[model samples]
Target chain A: MIASLALLAIGLALVVVGPRLAGARWTRQAPWLAILTWQALTVAAVAAVVLAGVTLLIPITAVADDLGAILHACAVSIATAYAAPEFLPGRLLGTVLAGVVPVWLLVCAARVLIGGWRARRALHRSLDLVAEPGADSGGLVVLEAAAPAAFCVPGRTSHIVVSRGALNRLSRRELDGVLAHEAAHLNGRHNLAVALSEILLRAFPRVPLFAVAAVQTRELIELLADDAALEAVDRVSLASAIVSLAEMRAPAAALAMAQGGAALRVTRLLAPEPPMTAWRHRLGAVAALAIVAAPLFLAGYPALSAALSDLCNI
Target chain B: MRPFGELEAAIMKELWSRGEPATVRDVLASLSTSRTLAYTTVMTVMDNLHRKGQLDREMSGRAWLYRPVRSRAEHAAALLQNVLDEAGDRQEVLMHFVADLDSASVAQLRSAVEAARRQGDSAPGDAG
Candidate 1:
């Protein structure tokens, strides 16, 4: 029990501190909330792990004897992971974990970073391919590719890149609709939204829910972009653009275009919004919160105490 | 980014579960497990979400077909991001998120960035 408490404490501390370091660059909409959720969920997850590990590692009676030792190590790692560095001694476990966990987190960050980089590069290529600098061709830049497609690459250096195929496949009005949709991505920073899902994947590998979040977020991003496009273009044109894009060849990640056969995207394109997505996101938020929170506190009292202390003390 | 009230949320939930646009009856049918929702209430909420730029409404023969303007995943991602940011407690959580990332991803991000750099002579902020 004591050992579990110690682990719980350590886990709680990570939840409190991890986001500040890792989720800082989330760079999407609701920057703070996203990081905090990740932090809360991640910490809760780690606590569950520790709680389970301790349960398996130490017998009930034997937990007391190891409490001090576990607490010390926990303190060491938490301090190393977050403290001023001068505060804690560089112990072996601390060093190992300090090195390992961040590297683990980099897994998610790496995707965004790489994708962002490739996107940046691809943006340049697209720009060069089109020779349009803020040409305002309705915020759509025709790329040199042959397949009709669209996607929104988010970031400060973001763009709604399109290909010749997409332009050719889609009528001028449909292309205009596609451009409007892509513009919405940049304006809404859907890329950042997808990035959050990516981070969730890294943090929660065991839970397939993260993938669900990814899928849902991708669809929502499209919807939000579609809404934005609707502002600048005609609904029918936008709908047709989505339908045609759905029927066109798939494009790269940054380019959110209508693929030839994205059934769901096609369905959404054919239909418009009502109460479905909003509530689904809400439920996801609730479920995600519960799943994330339950694990952290799975140790019952130990996890509860740890969380209370961390929040109160903070 | 705020919670869209439990009622509106419930209505949206119904639509999302069906994976398509729905009417008041459709929303109501899926929500039968919950409290009773007025037909007008569902109508109003979907109309509200539609106005909020969250839902898309299309005219049908006599009524409007309601669909999600955004997918559940997209909204959750956005909400998760918001949840991450709620307290501005950047003092710790950020580190935890970053620290948890495995090295392979870190290297990948760096490699991608490096590749991007190589692909274009543009400065860090100006990729154009």
Candidate 2:
């Protein structure tokens, strides 16, 4: 019981402080690593909170002796939660948190997934009717809009849509930069990452950490995509393409090339980062590993102990 | 990739080519040149298009007359608009294919493009 409480407290503290500490400037230098750290933190935080509630509900005596006692207690409490609807208020809250939190989060994520899928299906169908297949050999569709816009519809039949205004406005080099950037987005499957962050944010809107994670992840993916495009185009061309497309919007269902973190991207591009020495990159890797492992170890401790004790007959 | 399926695109093309409001019979007749299509199929497609806000219809005696709400170009433009405006919270940080810049940033972009153009003109081989 004491160990569970300690783990729960540590988990809650990490959730509150992790985002603040991780949002440092160095994250920009190593976005991929930062993203991994954030994802790990989110999973650990949520799991810890739920486990805390579960541990509280299970009588201490159940886990006081060994792992077998904890499991037996957990099973009993879950059954009791369902059978005894009229329990005391404290017990009721514990029962609700332990049983309902996971289900609620799942429902929230499903709603976002299903909603995005339906909207994308409908919008893509409409896009097919109106857009002209562009002259470019690449699978680019042309829209006749005056506003300079370019975006990609990702999935099995991914297509990049560019407006006539954009086609006419962008120089050949700028257009190449934009196309490469959008391709990076599709190839990276960045939408899935954004959607996962969105699910977490939707499930817990009040939690600033989730909101921060969603926004930061969205920005990081854009940065990562830009990094991928750098191999193909000059920094100025990519930055200009992004800057020019700043005003054009696309449907939420499609990942827009110029979406999220434009200012930061432009700054990073135009004033390129001073290359990190080998030691700094190595240090970053170590930090990322530490952040990722901390939560998993803390959250998994109780479960591991229970299994080990039960097997060893201790 | 074609946004619409074969029949939907064919139906749209038929309606777009005809300047006036078309009935199911008119559209089907035009499309039957290369392949045969049932009148009911054309009617259902038109109805589906109407529901999807791609077309508008008027009552003409016993039958309904259908016409595209906008020209093909305008429809294409509107599709872009739909992509822009449909995502409710999208305005803040959603699908921005183009940058939603303030005037200052727009000026900055214009200048940058101008500079790039000048550089391209002066040193043609610089843009590798």
Candidate 3:
């Protein structure tokens, strides 16, 4: 029961404070690390909450030498825990938390995955109808639109699409920069990151951490891709390419962040900064690992201590 | 394996350029100027395109005549519109180079680019 409360507290703390820490401006300097941290925080929070429920339902006394004995103890514990009038509320809550959270997350993930698959298929069909092969050897396709836009559709048959208007507007070097950027996106499999963030946001619409994470993941992946593009093309060319392609009007709801994202990316490109130092990178990695492991540690400590005491008795 | 995508693209381009319905024999003839393809191959591709709703077909004498469902430009425009409109929902499906920005941000970024260019050009020694 104490372990369950501790785990729940840790989960709640992460839900509230993790976003503020991860959303710091310093994260922009290390987008990949930031992405990793965000993923770790999300995973930890979910695990903590689910494990809290599990610990609540199964008492520390349920710990046994064998898996079968442990299962039997857990079944007995759950039945007695539910029957006790004094613990009815906690037991009911535990059952709901453990059973509902994972099921809800899974359902949301499936919905997003199916929807994304259908949308991608439709886009591929449209591309086949309208796109022409580009001069490049890569899976580049040219769309005959007058607006300068470039995007990549990722899948087994991934395509990097550039509008004819973009070809006209961008010089050869600038085009190279844009192509490298899209290539980074495809090669990095950034789509999976975006989809995972979206799933969390959808599952917990009210959680500020997930909302911030969804936005930050989108922005950080772009920065990471820009860094990759910088290796292939000069920063000036990439910056100019971004400026040329920044003319589209985003939806009003996302205007603030979308507006900031392009300007941030362009400025970052124009005035480059060194990446995070080795120590800082290591510190961030350690922190992420600790965050992910803390919940499991809290949930297992009681049983572990009980087993250790029994061994000491022998 | 054969480049089926290239063949489909070539047939669509040929049909769109003609701006009129063409039979498989006619398509094969026009396409043969560049690369030799079997008449049956052309017929199969056109048939596939028609099935995909990219092409409309009508009976002309004993053979089927095929034409693009929409003009090339119209198709391009609609496709672009779909991509932009669906940007909000289907971002995971397509990773755009730059997210759509309002005019104000665009203007801000443009100046930043100019400033960077000036700095880069003024300092010849700088590794930009």
lDDT of 3 at B125: 70
What TM-score results for chain B in every one of the models?
0.64, 0.62, 0.65
What is the C-alpha lDDT profile of model 3 across A47-114, one tens digit per residue?
99998888767643444566566555554444343232236788787887789999999999999989
Could you give candidate 1's per-residue lDDT for residues A1-314 as a string of tens digits?
34344455656555455434332222133222343355445545554544444333322222234456655444443333222222234233344444555566677677655755553454343243322333464444444445343544444555555555555666777767666666666665555656666676666666654544454445445555555666676554555455444443222212332222233333443343343345555654675477465644444544345434543233
Q: How well is candidate 3 docked (DockQ)?
A: 0.40
lDDT of each: 0.49, 0.70, 0.82
Worst 10 residues of 2 chain A by lDDT: A78-87
Candidate with best DockQ? 3
Name the docking class for model 1: incorrect
DockQ for candidate 2: 0.32
Against the true two-chain complex, what DockQ does each candidate achieve?
A: 0.01, 0.32, 0.40
* Candidate 3: stretches off by over 4 Å: A59-86, A248-258, A311-314, B1-19, B22-66
Measured with C-alpha atoms, the lDDT of residue B35 in candidate 3 is 91
How well does model 2 score by local distance difference test? 0.70
- As for candidate 3, its clashing pairs are none
B1-128, model 2: which lDDT tens digit per residue?
22566688888878887878988888888889989788888888889989987789999998889998879898788777766654324312234444454555556655765676577668877653
Candidate 1 on B2-121: residue-level lDDT in tens? Answer: 456656666666676788777767777777666776778777877888898878888888878889887665654443334223311121111100111233333333344345445445
